[model samples]
Target: MLRVAAVKSPKIKKIENSPPASPPPSPVQLARAEENRIIALAKLHQSRTQGLFVNVGPSWMKVLEPEIKKEYFQSLCKFIASERSKHTIYPPTDEVFSWTRMCTLNEVRLLILIQFLFFSVGLCFSVKPGVQRPPSLANMYQELSKDIPEFKSPDHGCLTGWASQGVLLLNACLTVRASQANSHKDKGWEKLTDAVIKWLNSNRSGLVFILWGAYAQKKGSFIDQKKHCVLKGVHPSPLSAHRGFFGCHHFSKCNDYLVQQNKKPIDWNMLPAELMKENINIQN
Candidate 1:
């Protein structure tokens, strides 16, 4: 045997294990998400007015009825003052006061009762529009939750609970004339709504949606139904509610959907009505 080549073989290096690279989003998904993002940004922030882009829905404008008597609003001013004096409580946000003026006492009461209930809300309509207000009623979000819990006596509480729960309260039409229901019919509200839908489809998934009417259900097709909970029923109004809304038990149903998704159930209860009596406006 030739001893001329006794050099040690070069040591072999072992390759360390590493995480596999994540696959890139498919072209379809990428295209969809990007397209959605662009549409959402434009929808929420941009508009075409008289062939020019106008900042319509995103930055709310308060166009109070120029025709209504000052006394109608003055009544609200008085009511607001009375509430403040009676409970030493005031609307937490300017929106609280403004929407309260638009809402009935029962509506406000219902608004406060959704605290311990569903963690999300889906709406068929925007609350209202005004010169200084966004086309949506998202501003009164906080005050709506100051009063109720999800478990018992759940109410709409100015939709504050839904607002707090990050609900998507959308409207096909963004601008409604104060006294006219169809004033904004031709104002391109449908396009604005499409933008919101695209934004939702792109930005989030596995959410709970409340589709309480034909109009709401119509929008359902736009959402990612595969990844979200879509709850449907009649509109929450006396006219159609008898068709389904009353016994829908949507609050509990919504919470149930949340739990199924491995989410913490909405903290439907606030302090017992007696404990927070002072700050609450519902105490008799």
Candidate 2:
């Protein structure tokens, strides 16, 4: 057997140029990227300027014009920043003033307009000094429960239940100086709140107003009585809850009005299941 020797041909190796070095980004491309970044920042500023913060929920914001919203947000931030520099403010500058949690602002059927919110309490209606007296809010809750038997009391200090039931707990003067009531009064909150009430009155119908104090009643006075229901009572503070707030069947009457208006009555008894356990734990 003869073995044939095979001659291997010299293979030419082709050197491939590396992917053209990805052509260093053109000046135009870089400029475009910078422009995009500027545009993105501008959008973010516009959102904040338009009061798109979650705490300033869209429901209320939608009622006011965008210009009004922008002015209000900027002015409020300016005032808060200035006041905070001088002394301690009740609601820290960082926290958004709304105490509401589960509210879907568009769905709100009732408005609870208050004069001024308490300072840093977390729970807006949680009255203090439990040993000396029962929490006035709790007393009011009892009255509500008496009328709507299934109404779950916010014993856990969470207003999620009330908020979920479409009750908006709004304060006219959202900020106050610590230990000094009405310190922030006439600082433009009046104008903003007035606008909100007037807007709602004109645009929406079949809504209910629970004006708990003289101030709140006065604020809601312009509300069209024929188109909506207005329930006025003394302030629910321990000092005044006894005078008229106790006997006023506002809860039941609110539902009655809703029924008459052909709108679904709020299930005052409905509370989220998750919050139920939280309520129990807080009690224990």
Model 2 lowest lDDT segment of ten: 275-284
TM-score of each model, in listed order: 0.44, 0.68
Misplaced by over 4 Å in model 2 are: 1-55, 65-75, 92-101, 121-134, 152-154, 271-284
Best by TM-score: 2
lDDT tens digits, residue span 1-284, model 1: 86796889899999998999999999778766755554465353223111112222211122222211234333433443454444432112222222222322221111211101111112222222221222222212221233223334322233334333334344454333334454435334354345545544555555676665576677556677786777766665545545655556666666677778766555544312111111111111
lDDT of each: 0.39, 0.64
lDDT of 2 by residue, 1-284 (tens): 99999999999899887765667889778766755654454456446643323333333434444434456657865676677778777665323435333354456688888887664532345332222223666677778877787776654444556656667667787667788877888776677667767877887789999898888888899999988999988887878878877778898999999899887787766644233211110000
Candidate with the greatest lDDT versus the true structure = 2
Model 1, 173: alpha-carbon shift in Å?
Answer: 1.9
